[model samples]
Target: MSTYQDADAWVAMADRTRRSIVERLAHRPMAVGELAADLPVSRPAVSQHLKVLKRAGLVCDRAEGTRRVYQLEPAGLAAMRDELDRFWLRALDGFKELVEDEGDPP
Candidate 1:
């Protein structure tokens, strides 16, 4: 997918509650109840945030018996990381060029 579409991952994680949910899922897969237990939000609210995360491809869920378990989606996480790396690389390259230009005797 294009980086623009992948940008959705950033938008999805912009909310503090959603970020909290993502952080929790990073440690281990969790059911909605398990996730909500640690957060101030209600279970239904957590579920709503999960839906947004799922839509952004930042998370996936599977049925574990009677409950739905959620976990970070590697592909989506990797895409966001890769994009961040690219951004940093470009910034560094620009700085390097600026430094080199400044060092030239004129």
Candidate 2:
């Protein structure tokens, strides 16, 4: 599969359930069953969320003996973080420009 964009990760995490799953995985890796057990969604639903996350490059899975374990993908998370940092830097620069303009004679 092609590498996913940071926007894809943002879209995938826009859902409450998916965000919850991400948060859960942030703490530790888990199987779909374990995720479903703690969440209100069904196992199949959790699996579906996993699929979206996987496609977005936010999560990856590996077979662990019998069950497939899912965990956060640091590269994907870093992409999102980098995007956020860039956005904040742009906003801050714009604010600084406005402040400087306010003090200018013209």
Candidate 3:
């Protein structure tokens, strides 16, 4: 079963800006200024999105000199992937049951 934190991660990623942030972080960890440069949003806006992502456990940050560099949280990403896998497995199971029932005589 998915926990509230897992649901929050999904909600956090529903935003386009947040998804873009995740995509960038997938390539490399980056500080706020670095992320803002590649994105259309302002640095502060990027920071705000980072906050949401962090709160959802989708990302983590570390202080490097004066800046905080952010990267994807592998455990959180794995949890989401596990949930998706469970969902697909359940759907396939149901489909198999339906097909087998159709093969039986009335």
**Position 14, candidate 3: lDDT:** 98
Give residue 99's lDDT in candidate 2 (0 to 100). Answer: 98
Q: Write the residue-wise lDDT of candidate 2 on 1-106 in tens digits.
A: 2334666788899999999999999999999999999999999999999999998999999999999999999988888888889999999999999999999997
- Tens-place lDDT per residue, model 1, 1-106, is 4666597789998999999999999999999999999999999999999999999999999999999999999999999999889999999999999999999999
Candidate 3: lDDT over CA atoms? Answer: 0.96
Cα-based lDDT for every prediction: 0.94, 0.92, 0.96
Q: Which of candidates 1 and 3 is the stronger one according to lDDT?
A: 3
Residue 51, candidate 3: alpha-carbon lDDT:
98
Give the TM-score ranking, best first. 1, 3, 2
How displaced is residue 44 in candidate 1, in Å? 0.4
Candidate 1 positional error at 64, Å? 0.7
* Structural similarity to truth (TM-score) of each candidate: 0.94, 0.91, 0.93
* Candidate 3 residue lDDT tens string, 1-106: 2599999999999999999999999999999999999999999999999999999999999999999999999999999999999999999999999999999999
Worst 10 residues of 3 by lDDT: 1-10
Residue 3, model 3: lDDT of: 99
